[model samples]
Target: MKIKKKKRTSLLYQTNVEYGDWCLNHIENCAHGCKYPCYAMMMAKRFGRIKSYDEWINPILVENSLEILDKEIPKYKDKINFVHLCFTTDPFMYKYPEVVELTLKIIKKLNENDIKITALTKGVLPEILKNFSPENEYGVTLVSLTEHFKTNYEPYAAPFEERLKSLKHLHEAGFRTWVSIEPYPTPNIDPENKIDALLDIVSFADKIVFGRMNYNPEINNFKDARRFFEECSQKVIKFCEQNNKEHHIKFGTRYFDNKNTQTLFNKK
Candidate 1:
């Protein structure tokens, strides 16, 4: 489907997502088409931000985002630490070159107005990123290293190896970098089914967040659910502590592992 473009009344706002206090999405739909199958998409569907699966895949760019932010941002500049580039959409979502260009323009405009930038994407970081201040925080969501899992889950998102390379490059170039290991999938109950993608890139992750696969029956109903998450959390916490990298366990992970599954997605 051809991508849809639209203009909006406003383009910046506050967010409850842990990474940032405020956020701005320059697009209406995400092209990633993740299969967690993306809680963001699920919420968007519920709120009527997107009407259907097909529409969500088609991406709607906020054509006047830069103009809207000019009016909205100055009013909240002092109150905002950094506006995350997106929560509902990937700033670097692959498959659509125009989305990447729009993302770069949005970031440049926000930075020109002295707004800090922070973003986590399933898309690869292009060379254009070097033009921005190294102070901007960058991140990638990596659940596993296997192509099989990614193919079955986050299919349209950047491949795991590509995400790893992106984070590594950012860290090497002196940019503050982080990784999101949330919705860390467990396709089957066996330990062999579990992955150790973290060990592959922990060295460069300036910050890390480990989380359980919330709302997935395959993992939630596993007999070793508690053991798996506990082990993973411990590993992440240990590495973060040893390397002096900032880290957090997503709020409901410990609770879910301890059999408190009800609170998993209860947070806003």
Candidate 2:
């Protein structure tokens, strides 16, 4: 893949997600080439940032990210709680040393300002990150353990075991670690997979986030999609409770019965 560079006027902004963290996307496009209807790609194309999936797989690094960040830090530092290393792109994108180097510098700069960071990636986390602030949290996205599923959907992202190894390394080193099982496929995409198995594999994480796949009509093709996600969310809550692991179930994944005035599972 050809690595390209671009300049941006600014590099930091606050995110309005429920978690309410500031976010920075130092790269445009992603090498992971996720096919779970990558929302980032969709948005990028919609905005004319890129024209096609073929172009999307070759990432464009923000050449002046560090320079831009230096200027913005002091202005937003006080108002910022923590900055997510990316909402629209992966920081530790696999096989892209340029992306990783820039991410390291970005993290160091943020830490120097006493700002924490939260990052989630499908790529392998580098070990050098262990030397950074332990307060910063690192996470990986693992929705299924099967190679068949990964090869078909995630394509260019690191293998599941490789991603898990890096996450577990960070966790065992006393750094905060988490996992995101998001845009998780239903039977239509992963027919023989089980959520519990993936959960068990990442049981070492300090927190687990579960959410259903969206956008892709194929997932909706599953007749029991609603119940499937509801039951999966309940199972995730139960597992987290029993293992003493923190958990977050994205809003739509949890179902409520207003007519009965009861919830099948307690919200976490």
Best lDDT goes to which candidate?
2
TM-score, prediction 2? 0.94
What local distance difference test score does each model get? Answer: 0.76, 0.86
The alpha-carbon RMSD values of the candidates against the true structure, listed in the order shown, are 4.6, 4.2
Question: Looking at candidate 1, what is the lDDT of residue 221?
Answer: 65
Give the per-residue Cα lDDT of candidate 2 at 36: 87
Against the hidden reference, what TM-scores do the models get?
A: 0.89, 0.94
Clashing pairs in model 2, backbone N/Cα/C closer than 3 A: none
| Model 2 clashing-pair count | 0
Off by over 4 Å in 1: 187-197, 256-268
Please list all clashing residue pairs in model 1, or write none if there are none: none
